[model samples]
Target: MANSNPNTEALALGRGKRPKLDNETVCMRMSSEIRENLEQIAEQYGCVYGGKPWLAGLLRMIGSGELLVVPAPPAFNVKSAVKDRLKRKHSS
Candidate 1:
């Protein structure tokens, strides 16, 4: 006999959906650059949670400490490189 519940039928048919999660509203202002970066990470990782959008999953990873932040090394100075090249040219 077929189950009356649509969810059960879906499960039986191998098309079951993930259970929905209750999400709380978190409001904070972030710069457009930051938002874009997070969106990019989400897209890259295919992040999603409880049928939610990629952003939510990414945020969850960050909030749960699953994602560790590493400090980036200082950027190389192009001006210094140019000066070094000039010194080498002059010293040669």
Candidate 2:
């Protein structure tokens, strides 16, 4: 049965609309020491700045071309992920 209330209809339609993809996720394995160092840097920078320190730092590096993104192995088939990241960077 369809929802009779206008508010309910609107809410149901709103749920169908997905949010725009603005960021691409990258998953990598890192050592415990590296994770600890990153956390420390993130905390220190977060105190100095207002936003998320690690994310901010990563974005800054990517924007400045300081960070190099090597392609994932063929088995991973990560072309779409890379494309999305490029699109996101260009859009911003």
Against the true structure, whose lDDT is highest?
A: 1
Which pairs clash inside model 1? Answer: none
Lowest summed lDDT across 10 adjacent residues in model 1 is found at 44-53
The TM-score leader among the candidates is: 1
On the 0 to 100 scale, the lDDT of residue 23 in model 1 is 75
| Number of colliding residue pairs in each model | 0, 0
What local lDDT does model 1 show for residue 84? 73
Those runs of model 1 whose alpha carbons end farther than 4 Å from true positions after fitting are 1-22, 48-53, 76-92
| TM-score attained by model 2 | 0.33
lDDT of 1 by residue, 1-92 (tens): 86567656556665756666797977878876556566666766778555544777788887889887665557977457656755775599
Which 10-residue window of candidate 2 scores lowest in summed lDDT?
44-53
Give the C-alpha lDDT of model 2.
0.59
